[model samples]
Target: MAAPDPDPASAGDGPGPVALVIGSSAGYGLAATLVGLRTHRMRGLGIAFEAPETGRRTASAGWYRTARTAELAAGADFAFLRDDAFSDGVKEEAADLLAARFGKVDLLIYSIAAPRRTDPLTGEVHHSVIKPLGTDYRAKTLVFEDSAPRIGALHLPAADGAEREATVQVMGGADWQLWIDALQSRDLLADGFRTVALSYVGSDITAPVYRAGTIGAAKQHLEDTARALDARLGDAGHAHTVVAGAAVTQASTAIPSIALYTSILHRVTADRWQTPVDQAAALWSRLTGAAALGLDDQGRVRLDDWEMNPEVQAAVRTAWDRADTDSISTLADTDWFRDQVGRLYGWHVPGVDYETPAETTVPWPAPAGLGVTTHSS
Candidate 1:
């Protein structure tokens, strides 16, 4: 689909650029939305697949909606759309809504992660499994639910080429293309606009489960999508994917052995810098206008500064190599652990009173259920 004709708002004319964030109700998406509003001073829209009534404890955190609406009250024209992007009808509905509300958008961020996907091209639904490549793969997996550590072997399902390709089609480029196409069709993109999708190139040790796994294949497709978008933008605008830092996120929780990685990441980044928020501030700065806004060496945004830092990477590698059950537990600074979790839900913030009931309600209209049934569309 081609972009709609350039409207008056299609030109960058105001401060705090208009933005849209897909999957912005929790974790990294929520953090990005908050940073854009509070730090970058941008007006925006947020879409999430999970609603408060979904009854998920993590999804019900009123802070997610609160942050979005409060930003609107602060003179930023904002809207919240709730729907599953995987569903075509829901995606179209969101596109129509955006077209009616704001005829043009200046920025878009795609931050979504799911385990299973229904391929539109093929009549099959694919589910992802994370395990060691060979049979002899064992790691210390942290039991967050029980607050204990146990060693176990992870066994992943064998992959079929059709299934792997389907996974990429559903989880990678298709949905992003749909959203951008819809926005363009409705005349919702301003000239010189930028769109970014979040991804990760985790440490080499996790290459089996992350960088070269099913998720890795999906990320590669996403990177390709970014490049395609970059080409589509031509000289009018730019689109790039960013390999962000390995912070503790809900998505990170699903990856096996990520706890150990995140533990070391927390320690290294905190010691090298002050907090994730500090790194996030720098990240948002580049996203907005702080650093020269452009792609890095990997043809993606270089937001993974801490992860790519030579010292930080060396330290994390050393920790991963030496990581055992007890060492993994003790190696990570607990103070940083508590701080990272607190920051996840906007707790322990400096200016915000965590004690007071300062309006934690906003509209989230999607299902927070990670267990969506995968069926071919």
Candidate 2:
């Protein structure tokens, strides 16, 4: 839980750069927002769809994280919008807000991961699935039952043509393109405006259900969009697809294979493992010309270098091969994986009093009507 070191160079007399982070309540989105606010001293606007706490039930983790982020950004200019990013209305609202509050956007980070998306143009809803294309996929996956991890076999049927297209529509870069178009039309994009979209390319162990699956198709579409955007921006700005490493996030837990692979990854990497925030710090440095831009053959940023290392992949493969119900605990870092998962929901965090009955209703700093919840600091 170590914080990233602040960059002294970013301190200046002028107002800092303005950043717009879509899906900024959790995962890489949240990490990127923190890096912009904490390290780069940037003004930021975060967009996310999250639920507030109701009676007996707790608020979504993103809700709590957003509140904490607002608390942390006490002195900075920051705001969070709780709305569906896929809708035309929210897009217009965000654009208007940026024009009035920030004047221009220097950086735009697209890191949304949603299961369903409604097409703004056609009013069609697309639901994304995590199945393989053309053929069935069967693999050994890790499942958590009754707070315990167990190995299980998963057999997923192939996605049909319609389903594959739907998956791409929901998870792909179409929405990212739309967002850029929206901002550009409003003339709110600053000179040298930079944009990045997060992506993943896991090891061979989880390729079938990840990089080679229906989700992969969507990611490929996203990458293509990035290239198109790069050319469109030309000298005015740049766009890139940042390939991130596997880590425990809310989305990853839903995918059985990824959960298993990440558990083994944590074991293999151990102390060397980097969290999303750590990667975001490095990314911020690269984006600001403070660090070398490690671009792959496709001219995209590479944050998965550690996870894709030869030795790391080999070890993961070895463990994945021998993984089963009995040997999983020995082969993978299940404890670490579980702990990370709990932290996503504001649980198992150190220095938090779980026994105390804290306030469940916490309000966002701006944009009234979005209810709130309390989270332990």
The digit string of per-residue lDDT tens for model 2 on 198-246 reads: 9998887777777788899999999999999999999999999999888
Candidate whose TM-score is highest: 2
What lDDT score belongs to each candidate, Candidate 1 first? 0.64, 0.86
**Global lDDT for candidate 1?**
0.64
Task: Name the runs in model 1 displaced over 4 angstroms.
Answer: 1-15, 54-59, 62-75, 118-126, 131-137, 144-163, 273-280, 334-377
Alpha carbon lDDT at 209, candidate 1: 76
Write model 1 residue lDDT over 313-340, tens digit each, in one string: 7887887677665575666654455455
lDDT score, candidate 2 = 0.86
| Candidate 1 residue pairs in backbone clash | 49-366, 49-367, 50-366, 50-367, 50-368, 51-366
Q: Extract clashing residue pairs from model 2.
A: 362-372, 362-373
Against the true structure, what is each candidate's TM-score? 0.77, 0.94
> Model 2 Cα displacement at 249 (Å)?
0.5
